[model samples]
Target: MAGGRIVVGVDGSAPSLKALKWAAGQAALTGDSLETVISWEYPASWATLMPGVPPEFDPERLAKQILKQAVDQALTPEVAATVTRTVVGGNAAQALIDQAKGASLLVVGDRGYSGFKAAVLGSVSSHVAQHAPCPVVVVRGETGDDEDA
Candidate 1:
């Protein structure tokens, strides 16, 4: 939401890694702050009832751990120094859309590990492109020569 800030959605997949790299480069070129958002949702069972266990589980902390791991895997030291991380809960698309409200641009991977059809873009990418408040860029993943041809 701050000035010259770009929001990127990351999920630790190859495509998302590529997106993060591209976003880092773009941020450097444009002097913008890159904000990486990792959204997660707990299982229904965890949310509804814990049975015998305490129900004080911190979903936000778990989400932060996931986000940190993903970011660590994707970013180099140079890139990591300039980026801010945000961990949130809920659907990836909706979380990203909400974050995009005051962003200069929204960046995402064209495909993730969601196991959707090869013929279609990942659902989160498609949803963000359709509904995000700022301009969206979907960075396509690298494909093998066989697939490219």
Candidate 2:
């Protein structure tokens, strides 16, 4: 057994789905527990940009739903049975790192659902890759536009 478990970050992105799938397979093969996590935070900038944002529309709830869907989509029923889902409020990278303390592996997508067109690695992936306590895998999305960007 590798230390504790395998931690994976999901943000409802295609790359995230791939990461989750990869993690699930690894966990099953290695007999390590799987922790599927999604992190959410109401950015301070968003408050100023959209002051009328409804409080009833909880971002955490949405993040939880997305996590659940991503896990369901990525892992088969048998594989998913071994997963433990989690939702936390904080920076995505930090949430993943915190939960990955003694994990054997930390997996994340190359980029999330961000609309930014400039960078190859998103902030979360870059942060987690640089800071994760364990080995990290950054799953590449199949989008052909990555090189052109």
Candidate 3:
């Protein structure tokens, strides 16, 4: 996979941070450039759930911050500097899948949804694993790197 790209999704979750670290390591081993992606979407019921959003509140900026912080926390300064960060305004799975086009690998994390919940509410990792343009690796557990993740 020399000269190729490895796309990974970061959502500020413990498992997602783990996936970022794993993806960075894999990218280093395979000589692939790393691209870290995050996505944001206003809830469908935003008007009812939360009537007002502060004018200064920016979801995209927050998403970028999360992605950058995750990469910074998970990878060394040298490796983090080499990463390409992307923040999309849509579903996380679709964003990763779209970013992974022509990539050698797509990496994501599993939140361990199972049984009824998993069946009822499909997970991003599972959806991307089934639909991504390249091979998908779902990191299944936390890295313990960020207690706050």
Name the top TM-score candidate. 2
Candidate 2, 10-107: lDDT as tens digits: 99988789888888878768888899999998776887866888878898889988988887887888877778999999878899999989889999
Q: How many residue pairs collide in each prediction?
A: 0, 0, 0
Please give the CA lDDT of all the candidate structures: 0.81, 0.84, 0.83
Give the TM-score of each candidate.
Answer: 0.78, 0.86, 0.86
Query: Which clashing pairs does model 3 show?
Result: none
Report the Cα RMSD per candidate. Answer: 4.3, 3.3, 4.3
| Model 2 vs. true fold: TM | 0.86
Residue-by-residue lDDT tens digits, candidate 3, 20-118: 888988988999999998899877876676667787888899988888888888889999888999999987778888999999999988862222344
| lDDT of candidate 1 at residue 27, scale 0 to 100 | 84
What is the C-alpha lDDT profile of model 1 across 27-137, one tens digit per residue? Answer: 888888999998887656763454555567776776687667777777787778668998878888899999988889999998875434465558899999999999999
Task: For model 2, name the residue pairs that clash.
Answer: none
Q: Runs in model 1 with CA error above 4 Å?
A: 1-3, 44-59, 115-121, 146-149
Pairs in clash, predicted candidate 1: none
Best by lDDT: 2
Score candidate 1 by TM-score against the native: 0.78
- What is candidate 2's CA lDDT for residue 116? 48
